[model samples]
Target chain A: MRILVVDDMVTMRKIIKTQLTKLGYTDITEADDGTTAVEAIKIAVSSGQPYDLIISDWNMPNMSGLDLLKAIKSTAEIANTPFLMVTAEAEQKSIIEAIKSGVSNYIVKPFTPDTLQEKIKKIIPNPVK
Target chain B: MPIKVPKTLHPFINAVEKTFKILCFLDVTPGDPIIKNHKVSDKSISGIVGMVGSKYIGSFVISFTAECILNIVQKMLGEKYTEVNDAVSDTVAEITNIVFGNAKKELADMNITLEMAIPYTIRGNNHIITHKTDGPYVVIPFSSSLGTFTIEMGMEPKKKDRRG
Candidate 1:
C-alpha cells in the first residue's frame, strides 16, 4: 500500500520511513509539513498513484497535521483514505478533535513497532500479514 | 487522575537517559528536580516542542551551553562540531524532539497521549519558559562525560470532560 509520512524533521521522516520498510511496506512517500503534504496528495491523485494512508505530525510550520487531516477529509477523492496521526500531543482535547476530524487512528509518540503495527491493522482492512 | 510527582517524573528522566545513550553514546544519571527559585543562566540553546493528546497539554524544553551543544551535535553526527551553525542548531532540535517523543510514549500508559510539534531551537542566555498553568516545573538534571544538561517539563494535566 502507498503511505505518506509527514513531519518537518528530516531525521524523524527517515526514522518513520525506516520503520515502514521494516513493516514490509515498500511504497512510501514523504512530505516535510502540511502544505507540502497537501500538494503531494494532489499530485498523487492527479497521477493516479493516490496514497493509501497518511501518517502525520500535529505541529509544523505553514500548516499542521490537524490542518492537513482536515484538508484530506474535505476532499472527496482522498476523504476515505485511512489517516493515522502519530504525535506527542498527550491531551484529551486534542484526541477528541482528531476523532471529530475523522482520523482512522491515533498513535502517541515513542511508540514501538508493535503498537504501530497494531494500530495499522486495526485501521486498514485486511492489511498484509 | 493527577500524576503523582515521583511517578510522573520517571518517564522524563528515562527518556533523557535513553536519548543521550542512543544519540550521544553517553550514559546519564538524573538528579533531583531543581524546583527551588534558583536562577539559571538562560544564555544557552533552548529547544521547544509542543505536546498534544489524551491527558496533557504542554511542552518540553532542553537547555544547554553552546559548548555542550557543540559536543552533543558532534557525537550525533559522528563528527566534531567546530562552530555553531544551522547544522548544529538543527541537530539540537532533532535531539530534543527524539527525547520528547520517547517520553511521551511512556506517559501514554498513564492515559496520557501526545501529538508532537515541530522542534525549534533558540540560542541565547537568561531565557525562562513558564508553564501555562501555575504548576511547579520539573527540572531534571543529568551529568555525562560530554557535559551536563537539563530537561525541563512544564505540563498541565488533562482534565476529564464531564460531557464525555
Candidate 2:
C-alpha cells in the first residue's frame, strides 16, 4: 500500500519509516512539511494513484497536520483516505479536535513499534483484505 | 526562599523517563536532584520549553551531553552522527517537545492549564544557559547508558546576560 509520512524532523521520519517497513509496507513517500504534503496529495488524487494511508506530524513549519487533515476531509476526492496523526502533542483538547476533524487514529510520540502497529491495525485492519 | 517542590514535578519526571525509554530504548530514572545551579545549560545540547499554567508558570529544560544526544539520534535514525549538526539539534528539540507534551497532558488533568512554546535548543561545550525565573529552579538529574542530563524548571528566565 502507498503511504505518505510527514514530519519536519528527519529522525522522526526515519523512525516511522523503519516501523512501517517492519510491518511489510515499503511503498512509502515522505514530505517534510504539511504544505508540501497537501500538494503531493492533490497530485496523487489527480493521477488516480491516491495514497491509501497518511501519517502526519501534528506540528510543522508551514501548514500543520490539523489543517492538512481539515483540508483533506473537506475535499470529497481524498476525504475518505485513512489518516493518522503522529505527534508529540497529547493535549486532550488537541486530541478532541483531531477526532472531530476525522482522523482515523492517533499515535502519540515516543511510542513503541507494537503500539504503532496497534494504531495502524485500528486504521487498516487486514490491508491485504 | 526555595519554592516548595510542586507535586506536578512527578508527572514531568515520568514523561522524560517514558519518552527516553520508548524513543531511544534507554531506561532512564531520576537521580538525586541538585538544588544548586541556577543556569539550565549544564550539558552540550539543551532543549527548553516554556509553560504558563494557572498554578505554575515557568519553563522546563532538558540538557544532554554531546555523547548522550548523538547516541540518541543514532538510535532513532539507525545511523551515526559524529558531531552536532542541524539534524541532531532538531531531534533534540523534538525529544523535548515529546517529553513536554506528555507532561503537559498529565498536568492539564490536574487543572493546571499549561500552554507550550516551541522548543529552543542550545549547543556548545560546557556552556551556561541563563533563564530568569521568579523563584529558584529545581534541578532534577537523570542517568542512562548514554549519559546523564538534567531537567530544570523555574518561574521565569534570567533577566539579562543570557548565554548559550
Q: What TM-score would each prediction reach against the true structure?
A: 0.67, 0.90
Off by over 4 Å in 2: B1-5, B126-135, B156-164
TM score of chain A per candidate: 0.93, 0.94
Residue B110, candidate 2: C-alpha displacement in angstroms: 1.8
The residue-by-residue lDDT of candidate 2 on A48-94, one tens digit each, is 99999999998776688899999999989889989999878788789
Off by over 4 Å in 1: A125-129, B1-27, B33-44, B49-60, B64-88, B94-119, B124-139, B144-147, B153-164
DockQ of candidate 1 is 0.19
Q: What TM-score does each model's chain B reach against the true chain B?
A: 0.81, 0.84
lDDT of 1 by residue, A1-129 (tens): 899999887655765776788789889898888988888998999899888889887767788888999999898877888899977655567789999999999986656567778889888867753
lDDT by residue (tens digit), candidate 2, B1-164: 54455676877899998898787778987876656545636588888877865555677888887888888788777778899888888888888889988998888887777876678788887665655355467788888888777888775423342445
When summed lDDT is taken over every stretch of 10 residues in candidate 2 chain A, the lowest stretch is: A120-129
lDDT of 1 at B120: 80
lDDT of 1 at B110: 71
What's the fnat for candidate 1, on a 0 to 1 scale? 0.26
